[model samples]
Target: MRVQGTPDELVTILRETVVSLVRRDGPDLSARQLGVFLTVYLGPGPHTVRGLAASLNVSKPAITRGLDRLGEFDLVQRKIDPADRRSVLAQRTKRGAALLREISAAMADAATPQENATAPTNSQLARSV
Candidate 1:
């Protein structure tokens, strides 16, 4: 679908999507955690804590803390890079993929307007007359 919107409309869609996510019964991720999760899942592979910190312009400890939170929910996992044992690679999990699907669904739903809620139906207008 062609998605053309003003800045305000875009913000409204974002707000609705976030509200839907917040209401769902699942792992609640902070902004930082979500950022890290998205980066690990969407970005190129061979991701490390130091690399993520550099990509996000944050400290290594901050990335580590976000990874710890994501790990608790099993959204991400860390493994030692065999090529370089000293470096740890961040990997995506099935649960994380599922969450991304849910997020996409929520955004689609939010983008589709609910006509019933936004306007009065013909039957209601007739009854009032």
Candidate 2:
């Protein structure tokens, strides 16, 4: 469906969807973890920790921490870059793909109107944002 709203409005809807989702079903993630996860899952891969850090403007240690959490959830895997034994690559997992699909579906549901979507209030989303 066509998303009919200002960008901020659309963002509000999406923020609410995410809050409801986490409250109802969790694999609750911090902002940092979510950012790293999205970058790896959405961006071109054979993703390296250094690349993620530079792209996200975070430190290698921070990326490693987030990756560790994602790894605990089986949402990402760190593999030795076969071409370079000294470096490791971050790869998406089946579970991570499933989570992304779930998020897409949630965004769709949030965008739909007259659907009785259950989520936090706009104020809550605004505060969080």
Candidate 3:
């Protein structure tokens, strides 16, 4: 029998795919964790922990924990904010960029055929990353 639900209905499937793909090449990360990492890596300008938390719609302590994990993996670095000695900015290390590239490529690959089958091309995924 064929499944009846729309592809959008399979939230867990999508989440698992992205999580598994990321963990395959790098540290294990939840969806939220990955989102936080991406925000710091791809976000414009230097990002404070508070700013990242705000952007992610999460609490500061959550952001701090995520950053602490990323730092432990050596994927992110904490630098003294030049404008504010008491504050710090989270920067993506080269290792982090490489991992991001790998994850992006995997996500792009997983998305392309499905997207192309329904649309003219995969430009949305391309532009997203």
Total clashing pairs for each candidate: 0, 0, 0
Residue 62 lDDT (model 2): 99
Summarize candidate 3's per-residue lDDT along 1-129 as a digit string, tens digits: 464444543443455467657568557876667787889888795989889988988998998888888888888899999899999899989989888887767655554445334432234445877
Candidate with maximal TM-score? 1
Q: How close to the true structure is residue 107 of candidate 3, measured as C-alpha lDDT?
A: 54
Regions more than 4 Å wrong, model 3: 1-25, 114-129
For candidate 1, the per-residue lDDT at 95 reads 93
Which candidate tops lDDT?
Answer: 1
In model 2, the runs with Cα more than 4 Å from the true position are 1-4, 115-129
lDDT of 2: 0.86
Could you give the candidate ranking by TM-score, starting with the highest? 1, 2, 3
Model 1 regions more than 4 Å off = 1-3, 116-129
Model 3: how far residue 125 lies from native, Å: 24
Each model's TM-score? 0.84, 0.81, 0.72
Error of 3 at 103 (Å): 1.4
